[model samples]
Target: MACGALLASACAGMPDSGDVEAVKASNAGDSQVRVYAVAPRDNADPEEIVDGFLEAMTSDDPGFATARKYLTKRAAQSWKPEQSITVLTNAPHRGQADRPGDPDNEGRTFPLTGRRIAQVDVRHAYRPEVPSAFDTGIHVVQQPVGDGKTKEWRIDSLPPGLVLGEADFLRNYRAVNKYYFASDENWVVADPVYIRQRQDPVTRMDPVTQTVKALLEGPTKWLGPAVDSRFPSGTELARDVRSLAPDDQSKLRIPLNGKADRVSGVVCKGMAAQLLFTLGDLTSVRVEQVEILGSGGTSLCLLTKGQAEQEYSPVREPGRGENPYFVDDRQRLMTLEAGGRQPDKPAGVPGPFGKGTVQLGPVAVNRTEDRAAAVLDNGHELRVGSLTSDEELPEAVVTSVAPRLEDRLSAPSWDGRGDLWVADRNPVKPRLWLVPGGQGERVEVGTPWLRDGTRIESLRVSADGVRIALLVTRDDRTTLQIGRVGRGVVDGHEEITVKDLQDAAPRLESVTAVSWAGPSRLVVVGTEAGGVQQVRYVQTDGSTSATSVLPGLNGVTSVAAPYADQSAPVVADSGNDGVVRLVPGANWQPVAKGGRVPVYPG
Candidate 1:
């Protein structure tokens, strides 16, 4: 009989007591078939009873008796005696639980639990040629106990011959439910319930074949070779597909956001060679203007195209207000203030003002909106004119009153807002000053480094105004000092001197350049005895720790933060190799060449 048919019949309720007794009488008709009435005892040893049943099944002597030990009447009647005892010469050796199976073994024994043998059925094959040891098949039914109560069975018809490997058996059979049986080699089984609930395709096709067919049906066609041009264009279909895909579709909507328009530029130095760039899209543009207070005075120079234009001239006298001024783009003329002081002379001519010097400081302009900020020298700052000049000359209005800064006031580099930082070497104490913008509060930071005649050669503020790097020269050696600027006038600043850096790395000469790597990281580039050294510092716990990054540079003159997209900083060396090598991640590769000077945004 087929396995399923046999299972159906055997799984039916046990035969009636009368039928069982009749079968028992017929089997006992032979004088050799002795049977005993073994009453069920509450304290019967299940192991001992099972051993007695095994002995009865295996023994060949006709005088041997059968015991109904622990089994119910129906179960005892279902058992049958072996007809012959021909022990197979090639029977497998029984193996220990941990050891691999021996080649000549019928099966091995494992500890049976209460739930494992709750219900059992036995079948006997009476062929004389077959070995008695392998003649019987034990069908064990496992009934769940404890929290779960499901019934399952293991049918032992064929000898266990490593049919399922130990790994596979443990993965499937150890769990009451065959939860792990559904896995393939690669992925875990997907949600079986969800998969079953989905409607199956009417015409079944392999997934690969279906994908290939869809690809062959061209994107424009909804089905087969017939193009659905009336439904929607191919471009529209592609757009819809992209829209349905993950991630933002707004990034894909190109040329709709805004067009690139020239905002404004200022000519620095002589307005002939160098120019600073501002953009209509300052959000995307990475470069920022680095504000520098010239030795002369502070004046706003708008760097655009190849020229820098002085936006508004500063008022030289203290407390004297200057008339509003504007710049004409087409004629390049400077008009006097409209309501304020009119020029006593012709336009472009200095009106009571000395030869006003202009510096390429920070200049912000909105070309689309035609708004601009013209930072002026002599402490005065103005906002003037159409950032994009049309017909009338763009006018300049004083927005900020000039602070009474010391002689030779250097323009403070703006960090974000309300904070202006400047480094000065005028006095014996050359320190960094943090001035609160629009409020005129000043706080000096950094330790006193300058002795009798020492001076500060250079000072640069970080992109974020939190850190100030200064190049100082004393009697012994020129040292670099880095200090942190606090938010207010409180003196809780932290300073790191060259002496501290020497303890970190001994072989160093002078710090030539220092720039902020990121918000909290600073890159120091200087000359050492070996060559040039580049060190990166991370601020932690109100202090800075330095790590040596690049060594053996042939005298680095300047260093700047890398371009927005680039990962490495640009270092200029006097070794004449005019190449901007990009250190992407960790590897160094040359990107741009020629201009070795570092250009920092204000």
Candidate 2:
């Protein structure tokens, strides 16, 4: 089919013979700009064939049938566009191959080159890498037509998967969170993956169905070791089901194969919770309840949103209406209502730290808002104390010997599991420590990736405890990275490690601060190469959209976001303004003078 058949609006202004003018269109920074691919024309040359094929891969065409039209019969049959995807910083540049083709001159080769930035594996997991070179060759040969007289140039040998620019990838695909139970915990952990923005051609499934399929396929490799799927092995959707839609009552009915037919009601409820959470990102559809059916067409179990929330709650959802906390100029801990137009004056908590007895540098309040952990006395010592009573500061739980305050211990963070995490940036011996339940003996978490002058500048543990966000610095450049938190027993001893580190804000040249804003989203403070500092939100998968950038602020030193409520204002410590916040639909407003390290309960 021609481009007009797919998108009449895009092709409506095209010319038949005269020169064409390029006109720019904007989506106002929210919606995606759709691109319809044009099929190969008759008597096209090698360059045209390759260009058309690349463009076709970026379209929403069902089955990618048009892209195959540019390839030879054998190549088309062997090509696997679904295998993987290579994302480039920009469109690939096509040129002559460095080496000549075969001596018989049966084919010509063209090099498709670009600066590779990331790759998506067969499981639809996006892995961002340091900028690197990407070079591949497409071979075209002259083939006879049906009558065996006219010769036409067609691609005979090419790369197996698709190659797309970053812009095109964002337009054609979307990042979604698939849910799985945390190992040994009932709460669901978000494992992010990329899926087609529209229907998946290969499976003939809509976005909702595609998410269900990914969930059943299991978690991504990085998170697989830390989470578990409730679905039994070999469990899958019914063979005949292609798409999923919610009925009038906003209840979705799912049909599973026989592998799930024998599951108990409790296990089935767990499966339903996973499905409901996995399908939460499909904003276009409303699903309040989920019903699971056996392959024999019998209802196995049904779960409503309320029941799921009561039985298997999400890790980061803390209900709502939590207050924000910060350290005032007097070196005291204070609090103010979040999402308030004119909240009451910040009030000091009932503790020695709030009484200005012990100076506090950076502080983190526990999820219950009853206790606080802080780097005390010039960032050399860490302490945890209650917030409801004026208690004396306890002995330091963790201390750093780094001579300079800047090289001492970082701010402490609390996970949903009630564990405390902090990074010691000592030049001689740097380490990441986890104090179980905030009072147990501290254990040094293993991080084999920090080496050769590379050190962690700051860190934040996700509320789920399955992931940690780190601001790592090397040779004066700081980058934001997200690593998986793996816990297990080894040699009759408990072991905790952070592994599979990948860039979470690859576009930023340096990151100063970061905090988990939601289950799979974060608010970051950083600057692009040669650009001014800006605050933005980025997903755990390292994906950022145009709307991710927040309103402008000057001299931002640190940023904090509430994990439970995204509607609440984003608080930050500014160099010019002591403390500031960005409220919904408003610009930055002053919250406190000389307030530093504002934070919300993790």
Candidate 3:
């Protein structure tokens, strides 16, 4: 008897009690249909055992107990399903079974093949890769059955972890942002990780609990060097706690183990903030306050939503995000009144740039909206001036002599620390420079990867000043990469560098425009290989959900997002539609007739 035949007979005898559900059909295969694997029958063939084991791995069996039935006892004991995950573009294909050496041997090996698109390591960190060939093998051998009278085939050698198709992986896993503080700064950074959408089989923990555990485990490898966690070493949920929920007052109380019992009140409050931010989007529970409890169930510290915003938030003032500026037809700076009163009307900025005195290109405003930086003289000169007063234009803080205007300088950006950053894309001497307080002497930042004809086309500094988004062009192909911003002292002098570059949008063949949409998300304009243009949101860890892709647009030249406001619209410059903005649940609406570049203060 085969595995499928045995499963059919066993299911026929089971009683059906649950409500009958409908499975909607679509062009894309439905992931709602649950899969349940059955044990391989006695005297099963090698091919049956191999196929049955693969099918079992995709089912909902607890601990994959059914899958182990088709594997040898030794193999089952050594296999660690949670070690890692390999995501394929589709279900793996099995090749014909063949004996290792002798044709009469009972052992046979089957090859598993597919196109791998991404991988999740033991730490639950997801890394996207260019689609590539995936090849592996599974070996099975004849084994003795009851009383050693009959022989059964069982998998003897197999991979250590689970392999899932894209659709199934999407259904079973969810992307979550784990919060960690910037190494030297108090601001928290988002470290993305994937967890089971449903209850984890081995841990038997709910989704919220799983995310909390992952957060306590600390940051991912790529971001570990730049961020720190407030949770004490070896700190975890109190033993015997299975689920967490808020009380009637919307306050969630998290009980930690003994390791966290000795922390100071300040450190405890930081831990509460980390917990609040980490669980912000993971659950529907309205958590207005987080109270940390010691091992003995005594409250150590408490942090409210309002308190976290005022003290440990990325944006100190919520009002700073309302002023979004853009470059108009006359090459002047203009601001949109987005405070629910005359939302579409454009007003002139209060300075000389608003009076059209200087022809500006790409522009960036300081976080306080009191200062602005622009590329003047067709990108050859970088200028910074006050936006609140009609003061004379300041001298050029930086200049480039690249022969062509296009190769002179990229857009200028301001981080939350009031520092200015820009890249000179000159082929002869490419460099990245940072100006402290937008007035200090520019310090050249080292970028070792900018070599062999590779130049930065554009760059956006994250609001935390700990990460930067770069559009790097090499061999005529541009890709979006996120690099860590390191600031420290080297041999007596202060040093700043951007290092540990990771591809943030691996699926896009080329990226033309990119901006930081939130702490851990980016709005990018790019296209996949052999595909049309697209606008999408990609996580810093290189993961995207099914709904990440936005609606189609004609042609997007630049994209900008407000880091402080999640409700603010995404502004973009379109060649065919002029300036437009995409608000939630609405289509793109025209903002200006000839606006070229729209930007929100970082």
Candidate 1: stretches off by over 4 Å: 1-412, 427-431, 438-454, 460-466, 487-507, 530-548, 551-555, 562-597
The lDDT of each candidate is 0.29, 0.83, 0.83
What ranges in model 2 sit over 4 Å off?
A: 1-34, 96-104, 314-317, 339-341
Global lDDT of model 2: 0.83
TM-score of model 2 vs. true structure: 0.93
Better of 1 and 3 by TM-score: 3
For candidate 3, lDDT tens digit of each residue in 467-534?
A: 99999998888999999998889999779999999899888899999988888899999999999999
CA shift of 147, model 3, Å: 2.6
TM-score per candidate, in order? 0.28, 0.93, 0.94
lDDT of 1 by residue, 106-211 (tens): 2323232111101001111111111123323332223232365642222222222111111111211110000000111110010000000011121132222222
After TM-score superposition, the amount by which residue 217's alpha carbon in candidate 3 deviates from its true location, in angstroms, is 0.9
Worst 10 residues of 1 by lDDT: 187-196
Q: Could you arrange the candidates by TM-score from highest to lowest?
A: 3, 2, 1
Off by over 4 Å in 3: 1-34, 99-104, 319-321
